[model samples]
Target: MGILSRILNRRADPPRQTRMLEGASGKRWPSTPAFGATGSEVLAGAAQVRGRARHLRFNDPTAANAAEILRTALVGYGATLTSGAEETDSAFADWAAAVHLGELEGEIIDSLATDGEALIILRTDDRGALRLQHVPAEQLDESYTVELGGGRYIAAGIEYDADDQPIAYHFRPARPTDQYQTFRAPIRVVAADVLHLFRRQGAGQTRGLSWFAPVILPLNELSQLQDALQVTAKIQAMMCGFLIDQNGGATSPLGDGESPLDVSLEPGTMRVLPSGWDVRFTTPQQMAQSVELVAVSLRQIAAGLQMPEFLLSGDMRGVNYSSARTALIQFRR
Candidate 1:
C-alpha cells in the first residue's frame, strides 16, 4: 500500500487501550499529560514523581520516623523527589513545540502562493543523525539561448531549407528601407558584422513568411559596374522569406536564384517585384557599395515572397503586400 493509504488506515482505526498498574498499596497515578506533549516531557514527569510522598503524619511521637516510612511507601507507590525538575523540562518542551508549529505554517503559506507542493521525509546520515528534509517542486519545461559572433560580418539571419540545412546570411548594409535608390551596388564586406542571435520562440515548427516589397535595381548599370571593377558579379534582387524558427533563430536568404535575396550591383537601379512572390538578385561588385545594396534590398525581396492570408491582412507595423497585390489584381480582374 502507498504511504498515504497506510497513514489513512491507521488514523481510521480505534485507539488501543493502555494498561496501568493498580493496587491498594500503590500511590495514586498522576493525571495523564496534555494532548500533543513530547515523549521527553512524559518520560521526565514519570521519573520525577516515581517515589515522593504527598503528606506526613505529625501526631505520632515517631512522626518523623513515620514520615520517613511514608516516604518509602510513596516510593513503592511510584513517587520521586524530582517534581521541580520535571516541571522545568516540560516548559522547555512547550517552547520548542510553539516554534516548530510556526515554521510549519509559514511553509504551507509559501507553497500555496507558488502553486507548489512540499514533501516531507526523514533521513539518516552516515553518522546516524536523523533529520527532516523538505523537497521543492520541479518545472517540466525550461529553455535558454546561446549567441555566437564572428568578425565584423554580423549574421543577419540563418535559414533552414526544406532539407533542414542551415544557410547563414550576413548583411553589410543595415535596415530594411535602405534599398530605395541604390539597388545595384555590391554590399561592403568591411561594413558587415556577424552576430548569432538565438531565442526560444515556440514549439518546433516553421512560421509563415511576412511579405514586403523589395526594390530591385536595373541590370544594365549592374553589368557596367561589374565590368569596371573587373569582378565576376551576378547582380540579382528579389523579395525574400523570413521567419523566427522554433529555436528562435531568424530565417532568411529566401527565394530561388544564384545571389542571396536583397542584394545588388553598383550601377543598376533596383527594381520592385510583384507582391507575394519570392525572387533572387545575384551580383558581384568590389567595394562597400555592394554591402549597402544588400541591406536596402530586403524591403522589395520580402514583399515578393508568399505568406499566409491572415498575416497579410493582420495589423502589422509595415505595409501589407498581400493587400496591395489583391487590390491591383482586383482592378485587373
Candidate 2:
C-alpha cells in the first residue's frame, strides 16, 4: 500500500513531547539560548532576511470582518495568516521579532543616508539585543556604520562588490529543515534498515504468517534462516494484513481473538489456518514499536537472501483472507 494509506490505517499513538531543561528560576530554558547566529562562521552563512507584521481585533460587532481585515493587512506585508487565537498567539512572538527588525531597519535607513538605497542589517545578539548595521548601496566599498548604545558607533567593513545594489531583499523565513541539518538522520536510518530487511524476505520462498513474526525469532534461528536462503539478512520485510470475513467481505477486527484466520502473510504461498481471528498480544503503541522492530529484521533478511529489486518491492497489504486470495498472488513472485 501507499504511504498515506498505511499512515491512515496505522494505529494511533500519544503525542511526543521534548524533555525540558530547568533553570535556577525553576522554569524550562529555551534550547537555542539566543535568537540569531552568534559567531563569524554562523554569520557567514546567514544570507536570508525575515519580516513580520501583526494586527489586533477589537470586540466589535464586525469582529469577524475586523479579523479578516487584520489578516489581509498582515498577508499584504508577506505574513502567512493562520487561524484561531492560539495559532496567531503561537506565531506572534516570532512575528513580533521580524516586525521589530524591519521597523528598526526602516528607521535607521531614514536617519543615515538620503540619496542612495540603504539596507539595515538587523541581527539579534547572543543576549537577544537587536544589533543594527546601516549600509549604503552606492558606497559598499567603504565601511558601514553600526549603532551601539548611547551614541557609541562602530564602523564595520562591508563584504559586498562595488556593483552590488541594495534591492528590496524579500525574506523567506527559514524552516525546520534549514535550522537543523542532522535532525531526522536516526529516524531515516531506522526506516531504511526496515525496508532493506523486508526486501530480503521477498527473495526467499518463506511462507511466514506476517513479516514481523519471523523477524522476532531468536538470533540463531535468524542466522539459520539467512543461511538457508543464502542471503546476508535473516528477516524478511513483509506487509501483514488483518481481515475478517463478515457478510460478503473480510471482517477481521484489528486486535486479537476477534476473528479466525485474521492474519495473512505475503510474497509466499503460506495460508493461515482457521481463515479469520484477532491475533491479540499487545497494545497499539506496542504494535507500532513491533512494526519498526519487524522492519529492522526484514532489512537483515533481505540482505541475507540477496533478493532482487523486483522481489523486495516492500509492498504488503492487509485484507480479509477471501479478498486477499486473488490480490496476494499478484504481489507474490
Q: Identify the candidate with maximal lDDT.
A: 2
259 Cα displacement, candidate 2 (Å): 99
Candidate 2 overall Cα lDDT vs. reference?
0.34
Model 2 CA lDDT for position 247: 46
Q: What is the lDDT of candidate 1?
A: 0.33
lDDT of 2 at 14: 73
TM-score of 2: 0.16
RMSD of each: 43.3, 30.2
Instruction: In angstroms, give how far residue 254 of model 1 lies from its true place.
Output: 57
- Please report the candidate that would top TM-score against the real structure: 2
Off by over 4 Å in 1: 1-101, 125-130, 139-333
Reference-based lDDT, residue 300, model 1: 28
Per-candidate clashes, comma-separated: 63, 36
- Misplaced by over 4 Å in model 2 are 1-90, 93-102, 108-113, 127-132, 135-139, 143-333
Error of 1 at 146 (Å): 32
